[model samples]
Target: MSVESIDAHQHFWDPSRGDYGWLTPELGGLYREFGPDDLKPLREAENVSRTVVVQAAQTVDETRYLLDLARNDSSIAGVVGWVPLDAPNAADLIDELAREPKFKAVRPMLQDLPDDRWIENPALAPAIHALIKNNLAFDALIFPRHVASLKIFAKRFPDLRIVIDHGAKPQIKDGGAGWQIWADGMAELAALPQGLRCKLSGLATEAAPGWTTAILKPYVDHLLKQFGPDRLMWGSDWPVLNLNGDYAQWHDAARQLTSHLNAPQQQALFGDTAKTFYRL
Candidate 1:
């Protein structure tokens, strides 16, 4: 069988541009320039037919940058760009980006912020609705604490398609102290309309450095149980995975996790779900 795969999450950044201020040298491995060329070898090695590039910085310019890249590169099947959801012309931004067919969705990096910032901010709600109005998905880059607010947002806007990134970012490295909070929140979010799904990437990074699938199994199993295989998708989170492991290592772990599932279910996790949800 051909090893066709679709990477649903990965990022690109240019250090000369000074865009990713958060990427410090102390973080070690992933603090260098990462672009399409850096990803090509790994994609070919793993047989990834296409990839969905998610935004790393919070700038509209980054959105346009990815759109331009997608226009030139067929390997980049879609892009999850960022826009100022609470800015004055948020609706206009969404509408404008929707004109680009490769602009599959928008993501605000809410997970890295303080717990209470824009979880349910009134101003951002309308902007989120504008995403739905324009037929775009919203990637929820949220932590466990933000899940409750995410539940509220999902219920309030039943029509919007939202993909939960990083398996709701469970606290694997923290001895799973925050697992219950994340699991409960995921249950609530999963109960929302069929639009809700989660990405099975970044789990190894979430664990302590040099962590293994045994360390990540609980969190992965929990998401599969809560969202089911059809509502789940796989993402390599490459280059970023260099912070903890390599692309092959991460991909193998994901394959091991779902090795028991039948062929169709495995296909959804590998590619079809993302293609269907993101309209790639």
Candidate 2:
């Protein structure tokens, strides 16, 4: 088989279906609908063979919408979606969704929740256990503030596979005052014996206006140094990417940033790590 290139993080959404609380008219170009057709050419242009469509909204109905999309779209090899993880029936719901072949993981939208320690709540235990029992990974949709809790969460269930989305979204644009905390958090997670990984996505948007590869290199380098290629995955975080830059620009910038790695290491970042982490 030919070696694969996967865009491990990406999404397809339509505002009409309506669970996207964050997708308001204020987001400008992103306020409209976006789907596989919109991303097909972009992925093809970068030689990406497949993508993992992640949840942009927090609802079972939205998960169903994505699962239905994945069923028809061969290029969507896996899906990381949402569920009410703290609900009493969360386990049963996870079991049902786990039955879908394309359903690979669950992301709780933890960053938006009021409680930074929400992932550690005893109430979410049932959902967390069910994910383990059903063989689903957890995509930590978190920010830097949640990193400490994430490390605790990872330890509580060491068997559950966890991938940190967007390198815990370091405070890049605001200057690197928080760099040490983000770096320390990554090191703690990476130091865990197993079942932890990180994604090199969403950094461009984190930097917001006037971001370049140079501005992002330190954060990227820290992730690489901490997680290493085996535990780090590359992703587009696209459409949201439109706010700061375009698809090709981000792809090219990532290429330039990681150019120093050898062939195998490069392959791991671009594709292999995501494939193994998501079991895709």
Best model per lDDT = 2
Give TM-scores for every candidate, taking all chains together and pairing residue i with residue i. Answer: 0.95, 0.97
Q: For model 2, what is the alpha-carbon lDDT of residue 46?
A: 88
Runs in model 1 with CA error above 4 Å? Answer: 1-3, 115-117
lDDT of 1 by residue, 1-280 (tens): 7645899999877766667768778877777878888899988887788999999888888788888888998999999999988898998989888999899999989877665447578788768888988889989998878877887778778888999998877888889787777889888888887559999988887889988888888888888898888889899877788878899899988989889889989999999889988998
C-alpha local distance difference test of each model: 0.86, 0.91
- For candidate 1, the TM-score is 0.95
- RMSD (CA, Å), each prediction: 1.5, 1.1
The top-ranked prediction according to TM-score is: 2
Q: After superposing candidate 2 on the true structure, give the runs of residues whose Cα lies further than 4 Å from its correct spot.
A: none
